[model samples]
Target: MTTTTAIGYENNLPTNDPASLIERTIDVPALGAHDLLVEVRAVSVNPVDVKLRAGAHAGGFRVLGFDAAGIVREVGDAVTLFAPGDEVFYAGSIDRPGTNQRLHGVDERIVGRKPRSLSFADAAALPLTAITAWETLFDRFALTPDDTGTLLVIGATGGVGSVMLQLAEALLPGVTVIATASDPERAAWVRELGAEHTVDHHGDLAAQVLSLAPGGVDWLFTAHSEGQIGLYSQIVRPFGQITAIDDGPRDIAPLKAKSITWHWKLMFTRPLHQTPDLIEQHRLLDTVAGLVDDSRLRTTTTRTLTPINAATLREAHELVETGRTLGKIVLHDGN
Candidate 1:
């Protein structure tokens, strides 16, 4: 096909507006030497998509999405890891157009073979969150199988935390996870994902955590930390490390006495920077696929919508903005 159908937006607007997302046909994106032309089958929404939509001011329509599961339709000359017909999953680069189109082009280095056990919709839920979770644990926290300590995860029922807990269960035998959930449903959900303990984020976090671990947790990872640094400072052990995929803490003054080290992780960093280790994403996705096929890890897809289009995309974006979602929300072309 010379062109493909896509859902995108021409300006920043409230998702409730009919103009927020529009369907159009555009020329199929050109491929770089390492790019793969993929026929996208499924996609999942992330908070980044919501943020970008509200703040973006593209001169033309800007496609919005990151996570995708698809099949290779064509491969660039330098691509050796995959070829036409290979089933694949990946989170596209922040610097690129994205994967919300019928045909999307992405670097092969950031793509992976989709898990044989999962359908495209299920597979789509894994890439973006899985990449962020994997990077937060192994790359930012530098966790290993031999490491023995407590990991406190805020927003434990959200996309990243859901997968992070599962990855820890499969990869970190010695580590104990304590997750923060707002209510009974979320609390029970995180426990099933391998959280050793769950604390109510709406209650006394420090007291609850202190009751669970008197000396405080060894590491802390939070998805949203706009004004929670004071609370976090009271629970983390001295010299403990912290990583945040969101805005992180508002103030570090309370944490200074404990000599805490805070790190920021955005899975897009490597790809946007074109880092030497950009291909690590490919390796990690392949590894996660193996885990999924082995039944050691599972997709966190909580809801699936069909017939990806303007209306559906806007609906999916609004669902994410509600902040009540348990896991990932996905949409597919039904191909």
Candidate 2:
């Protein structure tokens, strides 16, 4: 109905370019049926944000962000899950204008109550990565609370893996979590997040993994499938499973020998397709919030920038592009 300030890009450009992201005045998004109009308080930057910002949007401009924490301002006629004063968190669908704006309209089915124990900035860091890890475990891998096995997580210090390690420890106490961290600092970080063992992904993956588990792992979660698919096949046990979020052509021929099942995840699939079960995201986020409140899980936010402006978002994108951030980076609305 009105307008609000937002950070967005008109043309795809390098993160360092002055025009890559800019402040613009946009219409305060109108609510759709089943949508919650949220006054976004904090947002987090993700690798997907960087990737999408590097590509052109169909409309020649796009707001870019997914993970966010906010307070509900209004709700669509079809929305029954939330109210005007509720605090919420969610990872937005790729098909929509993102969370970078002050006011955002998101489907209530995909949003959840923010963790009451966390600051908005910290809560903002959980949504996107949390959903990716949650879907991979409960949906793709079919991991259960009673299952007992060794799980190998490559790139374990980033947002998704960091949260995954915690989830595994809490939800599948019988399943051991072995995480890959290239350096001792990262190793310590993973350990703090509940990783039972640490291996260097830069080293001999097979040797390290086999040393930890003689028969190799029962499940593998990787962020660089294209680079390590063959190695994964070697270190995962017969009939083991793998779920990857990497982007590239993966030669799965190596997996057939051991019958290792390789599954890919995007986290956006449910929301993009408007799948009937997409509300599972809401349930997952609520579960994560409960864990956070219970101290069984922790926010992966490692950095918090202020003001939620174009300059800060640019810096956040640059940090993500480095591919070395330990956890998530969040931006506050500076309220």
Cα TM-score per model = 0.98, 0.98
After aligning candidate 1 to the native by TM-score, how far in Å is the CA of 212 from where it should be? 0.6
**What's the lDDT for residue 232 in model 2?**
79
TM-score of predicted model 1?
0.98
lDDT winner: 1
**Worst 10 contiguous positions by lDDT, candidate 1:** 246-255
What is the lDDT of every predicted structure here?
Answer: 0.92, 0.91
Candidate 2 overall lDDT versus native: 0.91
**Candidate 2 C-alpha lDDT tens digits along 1-335:** 59987788988888889899998898988788999999999999999899888875637668989989999999999998999999999999999999999999899999999999998999999999999999999999999999999999988999999999999988998899999999989999999999999999788889989999999899999887776767877899999999889884546788898998888899999999999998999998999999999999999989999989999999999999999999999999663
The total number of steric clashes, by the backbone 3 Å criterion, in model 2 comes to 0
Candidate 1 residue-wise lDDT at 80? 94
Where does candidate 2 have its weakest 10-residue lDDT segment?
A: 52-61
Error of 2 at 126 (Å): 0.3
